[model samples]
Target: MDANFAFLRLPDPRLYRRSNLTFSLLFLIKFGVKSFKFNTRLKMQEKLVAAKYEISRAVKADLAAITRIYNASVLEQNATATLRPVSIEEREAWFDAHEAANRPIYVLREICDANLTSEDGETFEADCERKFDSKGANLGAQKPSVTNPKGEILAWGSLSDYHPREGYRITAKISVYVAPEARGKGLGGRLVNFILENAPKFGVKNIVALIFSSNAASLNLFAKFGFARWGELPEVCDMGGKIESLTILGKKLG
Candidate 1:
């Protein structure tokens, strides 16, 4: 009877060992599935960020962030026209003007991990790519990071009231700038690029960019985008101790 009891105790130890093994196998299977899912999501995000860039309208809530960037440009010696910094109130007013006209302010930013696109173009949605007369770009759908995406108060190519008349409404004096932190990332080009494509939609036929001759980077960008030498204001401005000519470059944004 003692031997029988000892044998039964041995079987109890075996049963406990089997139960532990079963739990370990199940845990490994569950962990592996979760890890794979996590890795797949991460990879998907990477592919999206790499696909391309896009442009869209800016919003009112974006006012503060856009103002911070624009003020930096104003404070810089080489970036803007006037020496005084623009207040947020002034910027907001400018934004309101664009809003009145239904014009847009746009930005070139990486789409966030969460995507919300609808076929009907609802709630700040955009296309995944666009055709450029030059090399094609993968400019994915992106909304403007500012309230006035098409206005000059921020980082955009703005028309300074072209001719100030009705017949000449098709023509507009435009200005463009990138935030201090946004330069050198092909933003200047992307900005004018997206704006040019958008001109016809806004009834803008001829577009103009007034650039200081010393601003070689901007000049080249304009030239690459097909802006021709249409006009100039000779040596009327001195910027940073340099007497610079104001070159007016024009583009047929048909």
Candidate 2:
């Protein structure tokens, strides 16, 4: 495979927890056999369900979805600096810049399971009303079973070369974008962690993040991982006539 485009997104850990709990409770209630004995089996099954989505190297085929995900962020005016939607053709060179070892792009996708059913003893339909638990957990019983189920990239992260100079090769910039519906559920954190663990393998000694100063969530997310302020660029972006600043953060890998 062309290694440059093979890095794909991994599943959000938060979804795994939700999937585990849903499967466990449903199986217990459906079979009417409640006991601790099923805990192991439930866990095993949960892993299988969670495995539907995976993290791997991005591939040439994923550029469209990646573009859409990035465009979504751009239109929202919170994450990326781009102000207009970009076409896949425009991003081709950008995608080409990523290599497996030095710079890589990863995506997260949901693999549909056709036979999956919901907890309410009913099958999921395209137009069916979704059921939720008292705590607002989605109790819908179907895994995405559409054609090219994995085509829908839920989130993505990347390691970008920080500077063109050879002296800056050891440092890289990090970025993570989660689908709007999937935000605030720990998916972004999971992607950041994924890149952190793999970045050193690519010879990265320091990871930097440039975030909008007004984005509290992104700021806190990086801070949680020990990334501290390195510098700032004042009034760098005009977000709808409002001047916004950018915060630079860095985390050195030991």
Q: In model 2, how large is the Cα lDDT of residue 219?
A: 96
> How do the predictions measure up, each by TM-score?
0.61, 0.68
Model 2 clash count equals 15
lDDT of 2 by residue, 50-109 (tens): 445556678777888788778889998988888889999988888887863359999876
True-structure lDDT of candidate 1: 0.64
Q: Write the per-residue lDDT of candidate 1 for residues 21-91, one digit (tens) a residue.
A: 99999999999977866656555544654544555666666666567766666677555676677777888
